[model samples]
Target: MAFDPDAKLSDVLAGGYDLNNRLQALLISRPLDSRGQEAAMAFSQELSRVFMLSLSMLNSNAVAPEVRSGNSSGVSAPAKDKRARSDNGEVVTPSKKSREEGVTRKEITPSPHKDGYQWRKYGQKKIQNCSFSRYYFKCNRHRRCEAKKKVQQQDGGRGRLPPMFKVTYVNEHTCHELRAHDDAAARMASPWTASRHHALDGVVDTARGGGGLFDLLPHIVGGGSAEENEAMVSCLAAVVSGSVPSPPPRSSGWPAAPEASASDPAASFVPPAAAGRSASVADDGAMMMVDDTGVSWDPWWSFCPVEEAAGHQLVTNQNHHRDMHMDDAGGFADAVWPEHACGAWRRA
Candidate 1:
């Protein structure tokens, strides 16, 4: 079926506006890709403009003042110096200045128009006898682009009630900043672009299954508590320090430290001590304590950044009977705290 172009088209224009509003709402409501959102916003803006232009042409007020005056006086005015005089006598195109791109007035709905361009609101004033106030705006996204608009709430229009407005634009936009902003938005959202670089790994981790944006929803949406956050941090720290086994072996270049058995605490850590002086004060102003037990543990082992010692495991050994062991060097090996070695060190 086709609409009769010659028939009265108010119903058609009204239906188009209804569709435009729905399209705008759909674009804003969904969790689509940012690039798609950008395109949707552009499409909505253009469609709205088309509808506005159509409505303007159908309105009686859009007729030229010269023609209105000529008809009233029964004499046609000369097209000499008046703005936008056409070569033919039928239509006139008005220009305020060489730089101005004429004027455009369109009825728009869903208050605080989201026409996809940023504007700086400069002024607002109530017209002398009118109840509604007019707002002036300038789109100053770029230093060279000087586009401006004036908006006032429409008084009892034929469409949606209360929030509709007549937006008048004095110049066209020259700033290509909309495209730039769209690109920047898309870049920020790049993580959700594809499985190749999903949000979970910054690039996908197929070995464990594609853990994209969903893997982070709990953390991102703040469902986890503060303790959970701390636990996560501790877990990562333990992995880095070889205290706990690392997460499933990733393609990430850093190899996972060997998981050491904590059940055999005796074989895990044995610190017989270095052949240096007894448990006296160290030259670094650190005081040491010797438990009656032969096994000594370093409190720092749980979080130390020793790449070479990644093979070492966190030995939370509570056994006081185990004998100390030494590294390849005669010095005792540095391992973590046992269950009872809490008071081993005093701050120097």
Candidate 2:
């Protein structure tokens, strides 16, 4: 079979148009359930459509000789309705290079700094009716590159919503040195990707009425039953009120300081004073101990039993017999202790 160039080009163009339509359909359906995928597909479809249209225009005999010959003077002829005109009524021949390189406008949400392209601020101007100023930036990658963009902040009256930025790109990027770096940075800075929280087993609860410190307390405490949690809360309440009870005496056979590992379940029941540290319980039942310099240590994995005599001595030294009451103003300074001293009892 003899090959025909015209027939081959026509077939390729038709196939390209068909593929573009199929991609458009896929984007409309949103099979991947991702806006990034849809945007990429839409851009690709548009590029394909433009390429096919340009090829079709080139193949036509109706194309003016001036346009085919790349003559700027003849390109402004009355035959081409698409040609723009200057203020002086002279026919303006639009930049052929810019026409070939399509322009795209993207509305970036939250911020414009994540566009991944290095832009140099050229100018700024205030627009009518808008509270924010419009900033003009030009691509600094190449001196000849004509790419420019205008960035303007979208006004959010009450700040109840995130601010938006309108970025109008005039020309295409021709720099290749930092293209990959910018793409990676944009992906990293994407709100969708950055907003994802790490999933931990039994740590986060998305269900209704599952908020607050109580939901997270169980996981932080290394898992405990309802009864154990209640008991822990009661113990914490006593500690906060300066009324902690003395632990029962251990047998003489037991070591002077019992070396209990953090993994030991019984270690959670121990008081921090037994480990030679000043202990305090937070409102949410988290136990914390302060060092000499007032640095609080996490109480979750630091429980250890103190000798009965030592525990009683430590409690007697720290506890003050004062009436504790919750104030209406929520100030704890007058409630049996100074506000600053209750560091261990405050919410993190």
RMSD of each: 31.8, 30.5
lDDT of each residue in 157-264, candidate 2, tens digit only? 112222445555666665443433544565688846533321210122221125554445455543333323334555677889978644322223221122222211
Off by over 4 Å in 2: 1-102, 177-348
Q: Per-residue CA lDDT of candidate 1, range 1-348, in tens?
A: 234555444454544545455554555456768887776777566676656555554563454453233322222345465554332464554544733655533334323233323455567666665445676766544445567666665444322222334555666666555434544567677745533322322222221223543345334422222222333555567877879532333124211111111111111122212111123332332333343344333322322222112223224343432443322110112232122111212223
TM-score between candidate 2 and the true structure: 0.24
- On TM-score, the candidate that comes out on top is 1
Query: How badly does each model clash, as a count of residue pairs?
Result: 3, 0
Candidate 1: segments with Cα more than 4 A from true spot: 1-101, 157-160, 177-348
Error of 1 at 234 (Å): 34
What's the distance in Å from true for residue 219, model 1?
35
